[model samples]
Target chain A: MSKISRRRFMQISGSLVAAGAIPGAGLLTKSSFAAEPIKLGLLHSLTGTIAIAEAALVEAEKMAIDEINAAGGVLGRMIDPVVADGASDWPTFAEKTKQLLQRDKVAAIVGCYTSASRKAVLPVLKQSKGLLYYPTYYEGQEEDKHVIYTSQEATQSVISAIEWMAKQQGKTFFLVGSDYIYPRTCNKIAKPTVARLGGKVVGEEYAPLGHTEFSSIINKIKAAKPDWIYSTVVGGSNVAFYKQLKAAGLDGGKQKLLSTVVSENEIDGIGKENAVGYYACMGYFQSIKSPENEKFVKAIKAKYGQDRVVGDPMECAYNSVYLWKMAVEKAKSFDVDKVTAASSGIEFSAPEGKVTVHKTNHHVSKKVRIGRARADGQFDIVHESGVIEPNPFPKL
Target chain B: MTFRRGNQAPRRKAVIPAAISIEETFVTFGIFVMQLFNGLSLFTILLLMALGLAIVFGLMGVINMAHGEIMAMGAYTTYLTASFIEHHLPGLMGVYLFIAILLAFAVTFAFGYVLERGFIRWFYHRPLDTLLATWGLSLILQQTYRSVFGAQEVSVPLTTWLSGAWEPTETIQLPLNRIFIVALTILVTLGVWYILHKTRWGLRARAVTQNRAMSSAVGIDTNRVDALIFALGSGLAGIAGSVFTMVGSTNPGTGQLYIVDSFIVVVFGGVASLLGTAASSFLIAQMQTALEYLMSGSMAKVAILLLVITVLYFRPNGLFASKVRA
Candidate 1:
């Protein structure tokens, strides 16, 4: 309330400014004490058709961030996540990726569940020279310098699954899928693999995405009487397909069915009773017996509640964060080029055992496990392959 | 497209052998019969969905874009009811499906009644406004469902009685769920026919639809009739949703999948003619099911859309236009 002379006020204000600036300047000079949190963008569909699956990826990424921060932080800087919903729309994914990279200036992004969403964001990432750690098993033949694919490609998943199924079961196969780029491409890989393994594909069919009427397909399967059914159907359609299969009395006991896409999340939706005994091949399963997986599962359950199921994508998403951390540390900076260069041979003791980044393709090498679904909506690991190098482009 | 080729190559290779052998001919016959049943079931569902739209769009001239969301509400209702039965009355789980269907209809009926009074009434004559408004309502309702029930797809437990199929031959199997859906559709269609032709409300509704001024002058409360008709249409959609749970998982976005198909069914059929709705749905469903066997599902879908567009281009009034008092 008291008024002072202008010179006196100016002198006091200047000293106060200097007093604040000195400590701030000192703190800024310390390399580890920048005080600004390193932000990582998480672009996922939190609402829409894909939300059922992508929401879990977001949670897994957050859990990884929390665990990394708890373990003395990443490079002595706390990890901050910038989450944005793509709304299950492809263009929205591109827009959000740009916003995250350009506006939020996140060090790296871990996102995109669907291949379409990933494809949409790829151009933006390429333009911005940003790094994206994509974590979904997809059709192969794509390799990008700006992206690190943490999950399996078609060769590692669908082809491996087909080879294993043909060896284990009979050679004859029936292929069914949802009408989309991923399923169609996976089936394209599956057909030649089945043929190469001396197996004849009895029937192959595709239903439109979100198509619930699988009665005709089931009937076709019945007539064809294939030794095994390989389905790449995804999303809500999976629930209907499995349920209709069960209702038609064609279950695991009557006929063997294997999938590259079905996991704990899908089994949860299709109901355990319907999905039980079906085999799914993926890089990780929740029931993997490794101590690393045990701790990962425990931490996730503790954070997200016991009812939340962790599937391949979620585990891959978790692995991506740690992989990014390892790369950043190896590069000693968050620069995209440096991190990408340092990413080769970067290893993370993932929940699925050890996963190493391939030297050239920016894809990871990991073990593939075939798991049989249990009544509790968890997988029982049936077969595990030793670490297989990723093949982004495989000759048919 | 490569996958489509992959699918077709095997099919074509298989077909040559199928065409050559008499034994394969029997197998082909069995498959054809099974596909017929499949097409019938699809037709049944499409008919049920289009019935409500036929009444609302055909009779009331209101484009209820939220019709699918109303169906989703019914599906969620069944899911909740089944979950409740599972948790609280496991002993009655087998018999709970009937009760769930009834509850689905009633809940959606009341919801439609409220929706009519609150929002849809204002945009009665403005078709485009009603469409936009109902679409906005659908988004709101979808978000509401997501918030209330979570975005995850939920499935209703199948009763033990409905859990398996009826196999008449070694090669042919009929799913009990599809049969039940077909029967339910028939019963509902009959009931709807009886209501529209034999009841006082039907006569009033028909009069109002045909000549609104004359019906009003004759002391009929057109507003009340509109609400009842809308609610009835919504209730039918709820029934369709309840039946849908037998075949598919229910999610917040489940309704969107059916909206366009149902609209196609209603508009392709004459909007006001129930018979036209049934025939068109049957034709569309059968053609789609048959074409899907010959080509990729997307290509089949493209074919169906083109067919529908061509048909509409020729007959904008629909397959069977009813003459109303002008």
Candidate 2:
């Protein structure tokens, strides 16, 4: 009814027209075309090392965008996706975010997998007062105004993973990870989390990303004789980690290991024989048997083919886009300022089930699932929490 | 490059696993033996990668950072062959490794030739510039590979021989894939050595490496040899990439992990000397592998690199520079 709202609607509609969402501009001049789609940017490593899992997230985001658009678009306008690859480089991720915001002028961005990368672009997003929807479970120890973390935080992921290991597996845990901000921070948190869970961390070690040898680490684990190996090793390093574990006769069912990041995507590298019986903690698994999840899995397979597998990170990515759409609709506009204010407490039925945005912390209410790797590179969900509010910055 | 630091053997002794009892000595030795085998396995893979990089750096005086991308080309080739075998011939994925090796070589050789003629030819003798340019080219190639192959690593399913572990002792077992890479490395190294020394093409290649201007003056097609040698080098890297899949994952950026060590091998082994490259590959592999067995992977990598730096301090031109010279 107000002039500003009328003009804001027209401006958003004009963008849809420019992006080819509308066939003709004839309706723009008309008095009554109230329906205009919101524009959201999706950025992730589509071609880099993290692509192993990030690719699935990209596809899921696309699928969600298509579904949302088919359902008459978010806020009565088609959801326009501006996709950019981080190329798995930290600086490049920061640069691409600037490009997406300044050049494409997207309202919000959903991107990043690694914490280093998020740290790289955090200042840029914060300074620009832009919203970034990060979808990976991470070693969270920060509270930022510009980012909405739609996945598990450090306390949630590590604490839950440790609780399961302590109760079901063992009290003594050997920790392994690639040396980076996330792994280091995760271990830092694990120290206390393990203590709190009545568990003891027997050994802690780190390897560089893409590292392929694990003999020394295996030997340490063997010597320590821990109840289980709690691994946070990421990327290509994990292949060698699991392989060497198997080669050293320490694979699942023999020498138990519970991984926080290991999922169907990494299992494809570790293979079924090596991954079977290994436990992992995450929010999504291919084995989650819900109607919504079944539809999610079916749609992914239908679009990407039957052999394609979906994982926790992908589901979070999918949910982030939809959550953004929900925020836009609730706000009744695509303006960044309005959406930022409106995003609080916005709820969307994600494949993981109902997720609500934590307005204060910029994290979502996420459930935790502890799954065991089966013989098919798929997971068997063994334990789960009802719903834990996202704890982005756990009290230290 | 064989990084023979004076402190190496002593440091290696420090790595001997602490055995609590006389009975545990056998287990310790078994672990040591497995570490040795692991070193050899890694050596084979690294040798395959470094051989091509050595030739390109030694002969062309260009850094060839895209060497990893060339190897990636081979990896994708292997992926394609595996897919074909899986779909068309079923149960032939094992046999397909041979075909994949050849395909990887052919694709990367042609790619290398094009890269030299189209881009690298102009950037000769400029290591830093070549480094930046080839890095840019690496990005392009990486993007191209990702767009074509999709972002996820396409698993090149190994044959029955390549899968599983060979357990000799209860504690010490050999991964068959590691064994395969080591064996393949030996075969490839011998094959390359034979071509480089025993063949006419190899003679011409050596002549150019010795003195390009003089070789060109003496009725040798030095320019053509440069292109072919570069292509062959790239093809070698491609083979290395193909073999690498047995031990590691092959993604778009997988080539990066090898590039740094490959450079260290080329430079440390007397850039132009294939034998030097081979020896350095083994030594570096042994040191890094032994250290990894003794220390964490990160610390081992740092230790190995420091050893290389120390070696370069003693032998600035590398371990066997004279052999590669006149």
Candidate 3:
């Protein structure tokens, strides 16, 4: 039998009290005063395995809101940001969406990184007629009236990247990804695109999410000797896969490699040296030399830290907030129906570039860029394409 | 479904070899040998991961479900060590691993000692209670790690010496980090075997494990033995975590990836035998590697899990169960 000392009990309770403060902050800011702030939910996974990536997006979202607030928030009212953690679970995403809609009654939500999470939250948004600003690049297979996808779908990102790789890197390609809807659907688009060109998809494989071991996969890759290895391995598993590839003498120098999921943030975790020679396709990179991106980068670094990284997803997440604000101001109301109705054809000169909301579909038209990883945790832009229109349903 | 959407012809069919030639056979044989080397590396990692759980569950009869968090603590220790060395002692960057490895063990050992005194001690003789308590403790520890380290995976810079592989043949390469892990596992396993069998403390610990009341009646400090043994197990896991950063990412939840596999190895080896643990980890690592080489990673995992279930159904006592008068 043992007893927790009073000091220990207080230490535990103190942290619990601190955690209790977040929801209270969201709840207390009801429609009390005449100048009631417009509430927007910033939801993402803040814990669990996916937190390594998604937590950074919350920071980006917050930064966008802060900047908007600093510049005199939309409609002469400050944007009161309500944050929720999805905890890297799909059902939790749905539950959090419902709470943010019903309980908090937030005007709009800019959240979710994985397509699965978007799928989970879709029905809730539909049932409640709530608006969601989803900011992650994903497979293009669906569109909803209640959701505004602020990132590139599969055809915009996948087809262009594969075409570029096929032209420059090699004709024989190998595809690898985490086993999920995004990767599978992306590959489904990729196989046809590779064939459309005079290229061959030499092999394809997927490891489960969070898989750490990849020796045998590397062995198979080495034997196949494909001209280029297209990878979509996600989360912590990417670290193990890249390290093993380097060790097995399959360094990007030996065989060209391009990953859609590996970004500056991932390279930061993977040790830049391991990923330095590889290439990746993304919607944005911190290295993009433009006045808009430069200012956004400066502000982000100032707010976070000197060592903070801006990846594709983070940039898109940052874009999500600004796009939503533009819609709200254009509509001149905080109602979801009014804002969403006035959202189409809204143009924002974002940090990435100029992006325009589609008139028909609720997706953004954004540029696709290919970059080679550098040792300093930044990418060297190798190729940049014109802003491709979002086409969720690409015919093979 | 062959993807011939817009191509001139399927050049793939023309390139397919009619039969396996002699040169291709040699190449296949070479690749097979390289795969076996990979299997050996995987075996070492799994052994290091499982050895600690075996001791706590096997020798102490305490289900330390918080074992993985202890491993995360060690990994974090290593990360902090590297960061400190990089900032304060830039000149000693290459050799910082030696010191980081030691500090990982020390910090986790101390953590384990305090944990046993404060929490696990109360649940002694109640295995199910320890499971529930430790499972809760694991969540708390995970949250603690997240709060302390921040929710992103921190990078541990691998010095140039440990970055690449050792190639003995043109077609075969073994990663240096894996080689280092193999050497570390052997030394740690020997150290553990000696501590449990060659020393006087080992005798008392074994006595306490076999007959706690008798050992207590004969004046063995059963509590002290329990605390030390638990600390030893944690220290072993700490070392495993430190070595893991060379090959994997380190974050608050990094341990969850290996916890289930660690328990599987221990139970499959028979809960009470360290020798059985070594055998089982090797068997599993090789089987998975071999199977993965032939199939997709998810399919290989499914096959291995199903096989383990079948084996366990036949041998519930495990392959090397020992008779102890409890």
User: What are the per-residue Cα lDDT tens digits for candidate 3 across A11-130?
Assistant: 999989988997776667644433578889988999876788899998899999999999988888899999999998999999999999999999999998888788899999999988
* Residue pairs whose backbone atoms clash in candidate 1: none
By descending DockQ, how would the candidates be arranged? 1, 3, 2
Cα lDDT computed for each candidate against the true fold: 0.90, 0.81, 0.89
List the candidate 3 regions with Cα displacement exceeding 4 Å: A1-34, B1-23
For candidate 3, what is the DockQ-based docking class? medium
User: Highest lDDT among the candidates is held by which one?
Assistant: 1
Which model scores highest in DockQ?
A: 1
Q: What TM value does model 1 have?
A: 0.93
User: Using TM-score as the measure, what is the rank order of every candidate, best first?
Assistant: 1, 3, 2
lDDT of 2 by residue, A1-396 (tens): 656688889998898778784545557644247655456788888776767667678788889999988988875677789999897789999999998888888889988888878899988897777899999988877778788888888778787788777787468988899888788888888889888878888889988888866766776676678998888888877876776677566778787788888878778766666677889988888898889999999999999899888888888989988888888878887777788778899888878788888868888877889888988898888899878887666664
Q: What interface-residue Cα RMSD does candidate 3 give after superposition?
A: 1.2
The residue-level lDDT of candidate 1 at A163 comes to 79
Name the candidate, 2 or 3, with the larger lDDT value.
3
User: Which one is best on TM-score?
Assistant: 1
Per-model DockQ against the true two-chain complex: 0.56, 0.37, 0.52
Question: Quick one: ranking by lDDT, best first?
Answer: 1, 3, 2
Higher-ranked by TM-score: 1 or 3? 1
Question: lDDT by residue for model 3 over B110-201, one digit each (tens)?
Answer: 98898998889999879899999999998888888888888878888887788788888777788888888899899999999999999999
Deviation in Å, model 3, residue B309 alpha carbon: 0.5
